[model samples]
Target: MQTTSHILMIRPVQFGFNAQTAVNNAFQQVNNETGVQEKAQQEFDRFVALLRGHGVDVTVIDDTPQPHTPDSIFPNNWISFHHDGSVILYPMFAENRRLERKPHIIGKIAEQFRIGRTTDLSDFEAKNLYLEGTGSMVLDRTHKVAYACLSPRTHPEVLKAFADATGYETVEFHAADAQGVAIYHTNVLMCIGDDYAVICLDAIPSKEERKYVEEKLKGSRKTVIAITLDQMNHFAGNMLQVQSLRGRKLLVMSTQAFSSLTPGQITELSSFNPIVHAPLDVIEKNGGGSARCMMAEIHLPGKG
Candidate 1:
């Protein structure tokens, strides 16, 4: 299936900006420290409520205050659940971020979902190589393709290992912002949906690379919805298509991202699925991740 009804979200206990991720995540901005955690928690709750209101089944796990993982809210980075009853653990770049991957959380999920073998790629972190789960690669599950932009957080060898293990074809490319700095995560620059793809072609400066990516998407029968660099800065490409309980398709993103969309882009995207957005200013600014990053899609079958 292209979309999943189940999603996993980590509730922040000590939610704040992290210097570790900010090294490469230009989207993050450190603002006043006053009430940041409260504001972020409020935004997180509202986002969860908004998703639930739209019929999305969300599994929310509260972060432990003891470990102090500031970026724990974005669970898609360290772990991903698969449809074939497989759970894949990824190698995170940040030392603190690695703490977000709790074995107990997977144990809790296993009670409801039939989890089979686990692919542990975390060992690569010892060699200074990393691939931060969905953050490193935007997956077109239906086509079995993993589109990744090379970066420090996304290593080619680790990506190839993931592709080999999952039987996914890797489409690698280099993407950067206007300043020529590499984008921290592929999820920030592109999203692959069931029948459509939202991407910032401008980020892939090389004509040959852009053409390769475009051709791959076209060949996969995806309607490309190209977002400009400015739009990408507003998180326009960070969208996720999910199935509601009633099987309705909903595209979830931040309100800022939604507002950045052109009328034509909105019309074309809405033609495929209804758009669902919530205010995420605090989270986006501090976390460097928006709605798509916050959600880890659960594709595992039920224990029954």
Candidate 2:
């Protein structure tokens, strides 16, 4: 139940570097290449094709050019669709990212998915508190556990708000790089699949917190595949396990991530599900997010 066959993605029209996000996201490398947008579009198309080839149901929405939202392609940061027909919207850290939460995108999704109501948490923006949807927390949906790494973008009160609203338990810890700078988003450090969790325990500075997270993962009956800080930086931890329409479970990551994994690590993961990946160099270089961040799993009931 943690994985979904259906996913939502936004096709970027102006995909490029975002200065607003670069202030915090260490993974984002600023590039001034002439054909950055063109290359990103190509990568986006190929990633979508890869997903569809695996029998994954993907709803692609074209981003509007007028808004000039550079980070629109990473829609998982702004909105998330739930199985109970509740579409949850979160407050974004970057100002321009707020524009990515378009009413029309939700309308477009409603054509084939049933969205009964929406819970807007964007009001927290006025208070200067932000929670960038799944980027702030990698959810263990089946257990109703929200694992989060507290950062400038993720606030305690906002996490509390979400927990109160959705009846989910929040498991929070501070995550940082070797330089001690915050990692920006939780998904970059860990990914929670249906039966396993790939995490970088070294990222959690507090020893107590590291042990606590490990206990939680094990207590939930999940097989733990720990990745190093180096592997995590290469996007190895940013994976998602999704069931295909034909009833096969598949683990999806970027080619960069898949290549970063060791043979043993690959073998351990392959035991649970077959792996799927695609080239996303341009998108990851400019966006500071990889495969998992681009996918917003659509758990809504199908329209009858």
Candidate 3:
């Protein structure tokens, strides 16, 4: 299935502007250090409540202060859960972000889900070759396709390793913002849903690459809803489609992302699924990630 009802969220323990990640992430903006963590926690709580009200099963885990991981709120960067019971761990770009993956977290999740073989790619971090889990690649699970925008954080070698482990064919391309700076993550430029794709086609400077991406989306029978570069900067392209406990399809995103959409885009998206959005300015301004980044879908089957 393309979407899952189970979602994993790491509650902020030390959420704030991460200097290490800001070096490459263009979306990050430095804010007042004082009380930023508190505000972020409040936002996180409200976001979780909003999703829960929509019938999505969210597992909230508290981040430990021992490792002092400031970017730990975005758990999707460290690991991904597949329906095949395969748990794949990826090497994160920021050193501190790598510490987000803890043995205890895995054990906690194991209590509810049956985990199959584990594929650890953190060893690539030593060589400075990183691929930050789903952040590095926006996956089309239904079609077994991984769409990735190449950047310093997303290396070809690491992507090949992921493809080898999961048998997912990779469609690689380069995307950049209006100012010509490469986008740090693919999710910031495009999102692959079950029946539709939200993407900033203009971000791909090369006409050929842009056309290739469009072709793939069309070939996969996905209705393409394009966003402009301006909307992309608002994190409008970082939406995720999820299944509700009642078997409803829901498109999840931040209020910022929702507001940036055109009426047509929203209507087109609504035709396929109802939208679920929450205010995430505090998290987005400091952490450089929105609703999608905060969620790591749990595709593993429950052990009954």
Candidate 4:
């Protein structure tokens, strides 16, 4: 199981201009009040400190100034680490995002974990197929199941390749955003942890598909914490569960997600795990992603 402590993050150098995400990420901006670079650093520092305070061992890498990857803050979309020691590099739909996959980043991680193999699925982009890593799919690592919502941004071929390489079963569905447009990434609508799942069922309008997902979660012994469309708009469904240093569990989300929750939802969730949140107004407004996007959990076995 992956915890917040065992995660990786990249500090953004050019945090405001992501042409790749701009195609679907209308939320990003360059604020005059807060310089892009300064704001990113401050956000990174606070995020890291919060993770560490909860006993998460965070490995932070500075983004290189030469090759600017504006959406570098959302590394989970580019790469993923598995318990089997295999690292999968995804095919991002965005040209700029494709550059976010750096071999050096993998090399740095190799110092602490054994990398049995590296699968490069980025070549599939030539065929117009993409699977933006964890952003395209929320994985139930313990069960080896990947829940994917198909859209222009998430191709089935790439999802199958990941499943074949990782030995995971695929649960595919179609989801639309508030405007009835296809939701760009799967991570924004759901997160699966050891004992629970937070999801926006309204996003999956199909009655059958929603029932299937709900049944699957129940079958897996996961307590379902459903969020409303309004809460989902506030990014409430984008929460992740991780273990703290003391082995206690924490359900991590942004202040926006926390504030969007109802008193009943918060009380129900608190029964499973304590909730932890950090302010991500600037990051969310400009990056179009929140806490879950900022982290790439490391589930690889230790080298030693």
Candidate 5:
């Protein structure tokens, strides 16, 4: 299967600006006078509905009411399930976000999928090293490559451990925000599709690093769809390519990311896959993540 029909998403109960994550995530807003939580929730609801409408199965889970996890809406960070029957738990940078790793969620998925082994990498957090699961690394399943950008929230040791455990090659590089601060998450600066990659080359300051990345993508028979830093800021690079129930490819992104695209870029991208977007202004502003952040693809082999 090109993409799994099932996707996991967490509905924000106390959704608002996360001060803990904002320290490393420059995209998050510091202060907002208006009540944007409801607006954000509406957007999340609409996004799930839109995906379901497209025949993409989505499992929506409401976050816990207590011990507020402001960044819990992005569940892709806390855990990742693999087709090989391995579930990898990541060490989150934010102390509050660590609460999102609920065993119940795993039990629920096990009802339909097989469970082999679970690797808990949360011990790294004790050493102040972290890796936010899929947020810190974008996996190229077909090629077994894990594309990652170095940041304070994403530790090198964790990436090495993941690559060793998952048997994926690590393609690491340095990425910085507009202010030259390290970009907190790899997903925010790039995404690798089945046969294409959307990346912000400008974010990589070193020519050698940029060239190496370019060469690596080209070597994999991938069409490099480059996005500018401005577009990356608009979340254009944070898109994911998923398959529908009908087995058709769907390029998913936030409405804000879609709007930032030029007609030419959109046309070029449409040649690869059909586009699917949902308005996520509130979530983007407050949570500092886009549609890709909200989804955690279930790659576990399902029952026949």
Candidate 6:
């Protein structure tokens, strides 16, 4: 299955503007640091409640205050859980962000799911090369492909290593924004669903690369729903499709992202799954990530 009902979320302890990520992440903005963590917590709780109300299984873990990790809320960047009961940790670009990975969190998850062998790719950080987990590479698990865009946070060597470790084919491409600046994460410009793909084709300037991506998606039986660069800025491409407890398909995104979608695009997406959105203005402004980034889908099997 491409989507999972179980998800892992990190409750913020000291959420604020991250200076380290702001270098490449243009979506981030600095708000008043005072009491921002409180506001972000409120938003996080409400978002999780909304997901739970929709019958999505969410595991909320409170973050530690000792590390002062501002972007700890986005756990998908540090670690990913797979259906094979394997846990893979990726190297983060920022020094402080690397501190987000804690063994205690994985141990907490192990209580519910049976975790197999663990793979640590954080050694690449010593070489100044990094690949921020799902943020840098969007996986099409069903097809065993990892779609990645090259950036400072996503190096080709690290991506190849990830592919080698996971047995996934690497579909590498370069993506840029309206101003021709490289996008920091592939998830910011594209998302892979079971039967469809939401992507900003304009971001891929190379016609051959764009064709390669489109052909691959078509080969995998996915309808391509292209969004413009403006819509991408609004985070329209940053969406996740998951199954509810009742087996209904739901596409999740931020309210801001949903609002930016065109009527035609909405209809196209609704043809595949219903839309579920929550207001994430505060989190998106401070963290540079949306609904998809907040929840790390847990594909690990439950303990028997």
lDDT by residue for model 2 (1-304), tens: 7999999999999999999999999999976778988999999999999999999999899999978899998999999888799889999888998889888999988999888878899999999999999999999999999999999999999999999888899999999988899989999999998889999999999999999999999999999899999998889988888888988999999999999999999999999999999999888889999999999999999988
Instruction: Report how far residue 274 has shifted in candidate 1, in Å.
Output: 0.3
Off by over 4 Å in 1: none
Which residue runs of candidate 5 sit more than 4 Å off their true CA positions?
A: none
Query: lDDT tens digits, residues 182-278, model 5?
Result: 9899998888887888999999999999999989988988899899999999999888888777887899999999999999989988998889999
Model 4 C-alpha lDDT versus the unseen true structure: 0.85
Best of the two (2, 3) by lDDT: 3
- Quote model 6's TM-score: 0.98
The whole-model C-alpha lDDT of candidate 1 against the native structure comes to: 0.93
Name the better of 2 and 4 by lDDT: 2
C-alpha lDDT of candidate 6 relative to the true structure = 0.92
Give all candidate RMSDs, comma-separated: 0.7, 0.7, 0.7, 1.7, 1.1, 1.0
* Candidate models: Cα lDDT each: 0.93, 0.92, 0.93, 0.85, 0.88, 0.92
Q: Which is superior by TM-score, 1 or 4?
A: 1
Worst 10 residues of 5 by lDDT: 1-10
The Cα RMSD in angstroms, rounded to one decimal, for candidate 1 relative to the true structure is 0.7
Give the C-alpha miss distance for residue 278 in model 4, angstroms.
0.5
- Candidate 1 C-alpha lDDT tens digits along 120-177: 9999999999999999999999989999999999999999899989999999999999
Per-prediction count of colliding residue pairs? 0, 0, 0, 3, 0, 0
- For residue 98, model 2's alpha carbon misses the true position, in angstroms, by 0.6
TM-score of candidate 1 relative to the true fold: 0.99
Global lDDT for candidate 3?
0.93
